[model samples]
Target: MLTISAKEMKDVLYELFKKYEFTESKANLLAEVFTQNTLYGVNSHGINRVPYFIETVKKGIVKVNEEAKKIEAFGNIERWDGNQGPGIINAVTCTNRAIALAKKDGMGLVALRNTNHWMRGGYYGWQAAKENCIAILFTNTQPNMPAWGGKESRIGNNPFVVSIPRKEGHIVLDMALSQFSFGKINNYKLKGEQLPYHGGWDEDHKLSKNPENILKTEQGLPIGYWKGSAFSIVLDMLATLLSAGNSTYKIGLKEHETAISQVYLCIYPEIFHDQDLQHTLINEIINYTHDVTPSEKGERTYYPGERAANAEKHNSKNGMKVNKEIWQKVLSLL
Candidate 1:
């Protein structure tokens, strides 16, 4: 493990991206997002995935130069064709566009089709919240998990995000349908550590913390059990239908996960007369959750997004930790 300042890491990533023909603006934006993800303690989606992202670009699965094009527009909704562009850039653009629309209308929606994987969906949620807008976003992925009661992989562990703006810190919930994402499980396995909670089932169909067995079986348990499975199905359907793009089941037919669909929705509070009431209600809900007795002594319970904010502070002061091997590989790309 090695620790590097966020600025240094961002510069390194920018240099590497430039080597791949990304323009300065695009490179800087990508680098900043990646660095922020690491700074917020999401290594599984940050530096750990940068190497594969580069590989995807090299493989021609992700178009480095392609920009999303607006395909259709409604009163407060729009559809875009990503043209297989880099997912992070496309997602950020769409999220911003949604916020712009919400500024005019009370609500805005954007559906993007034919995009690559958007590492760390929470980034866009944070983007919207920064603008004082509520956001809901979803992305489809390659089928890596089975439907409920089935044995074969048939559903995407599609990630979803929600964010509500607040003065202190935005309340954001970013999670995949699966109880554990493969990237997260692999990270634990690499560290030879057990999961803090039950993540998945083994080949013997028993709950297990052994990431290796879970990976081999590909039988990840869904969060909230059947509820998450149902939610995944609905989210996949909504993304595909709204974007008029391929569903997770269709994407699974291919060896690589590309040409995925995503949706972003933003709502502005200024248009509503009850904005103050809504804000108060949100705070009340958060306070209620925090008031619960923690399972461990001296461990204060936190609302969603609390840990990320704390991580940002600690990482900014102490430098972000990076896996030595991954960092070297990223440098090699430069």
Candidate 2:
């Protein structure tokens, strides 16, 4: 492992993106998001994924210069076509647009179609929450998990995010339907570490923490067994129908995962006029959860976003730790 300062990392990524034909602004935005993902301890979507993103760009799968376009608008709701633009740029634009609409109305909705992988959905959640708005975001991926009863892959690990604003640290929940993302499992494998909890089944159909087997089978367990499976189906349905875009099952048929669907929602507190009450309620919930008796000595409970935020602070100050080989690979690209 090696540590790289955030500025240095961002500069390297920016230069690389620019060299690949991204506009200066777009390159900066992409670099910033990737850097922040690493800082937040989401290397699976950060530096670890950069090489793949560059490869996609080189393959012309992700158009470097394309921009999303508004397809339609109805009051507080709008629809847009990503036109196969880089997912990070499209997602950030849509989230900002949703926030703007929410500022005028009580809430806003933006359904996006034909986008690529957003890479860490929580980035947009935190973006909205930071502006003192509640948000819900959803994205569908290529089929990577099987339906509850079936064997072959037929559903996405579709990730969803929810966030509530707070003066201290906004409460955010960013999770996928799968127990562990393929990126996460691969990261653990690369680090020669076992998953902290059961993540998927082995070839023999037994629960296993070995990521290699999970990757080979491409059959990840959902977070809550059947419940998560059901949620994944519903989320894929909603994104597809609402955006009038391809579902995970449809995307799986393509050569690569692109032109996917997503939705962003934002709610402003001013419309509710109960800011204090909302904060109090959130505090009560968080405190109650932490108040639970530890199942083991020295064990501590954490809310959804707490751990990520802690990781962000530590990594930002100490520098992001990267796999030595991967770092070298990225440098070689430059």
Candidate 3:
């Protein structure tokens, strides 16, 4: 493992992205987003994923310097075409548009089609929270998980995120429908560790904690078994219909996962309710959750985004420990 500073990580990423023909502003934004994800303890989607992102760019699956263009509008709701740009850049653009619309109206919704994989959905949620807006967002991925009671992979383990602004720290819930995302599984595999729990089905169609077996089958376990499968289906339907974009099945036909659909919805709570009351209510809920009886001795309960916030603090002061092999690969991109 290697302990690297956040600034150093960002500087390397910026230089690498610039080599990919990304403009100065875009490179900087991409660098910060990737580095921030790592600092927040989500190495599965952070530095570890940079090399794969560059591969997609090289294969012409992801275009450089392309921005989302508005397709249609309806009052506070709008649809945009991502133009197959960098997922992070397109996601940021759509999120800002949603926030701007929410400020103008009471609520705003942006449906984005033809976008690539947004590395970490929570990044956009935090973006909205920083603007003091409540945000709910989700994105579809390539078909990677099977439906309930099915052997064939036919569903996407789409991610969902929600963020509520707070003075002390934002509350964000970001999760994939699968019990373990592919990235997380891969990370565990790289570390030669087993999952804490059964993460997916092995080739024998049995639940397993071995990441290698699960990845071979590509049959990740749904979060709630049947219930999670249903949630993934509905989210996929909503995203595809709203954005008028490719569905999971359609994306499965592509060589790689690209041109997916996503939705970003933001609400301006202060415009409707008292800010003080909102904060009080939020704090009460968090306190109540924290005060719950511990499931394990000597372990404290945490709210949705609490652990990540703490990780960001500690990692900023100290440094993030990353896999040496992956770190070397990222550096080689230069």
Best by lDDT: 3
- TM-score for each predicted model, relative to the true structure: 0.96, 0.97, 0.99
The lDDT for every candidate, in the order shown, is: 0.90, 0.91, 0.95
Q: Tens digits of per-residue lDDT for model 1 on 88-190?
A: 9999999999999999898999999999998999999999999999999999888777778886777878999999899878988889889888889978886
Candidate that scores best on TM-score: 3
The lDDT of model 2 is 0.91
Clashing pairs in 1: none
Better of 2 and 3 by TM-score: 3
* Candidate 3: C-alpha lDDT: 0.95
Q: What would the per-residue lDDT of candidate 3 be over residues 28-69, giving only the tens digit for each residue? A: 999999999999999999999999999999999999978899
Task: In angstroms, give how far residue 325 of model 1 lies from its true place.
Answer: 1.7
lDDT measured at residue 271 in model 3 versus the true structure, 0 to 100: 94
Clash pairs (backbone) in predicted model 2: none
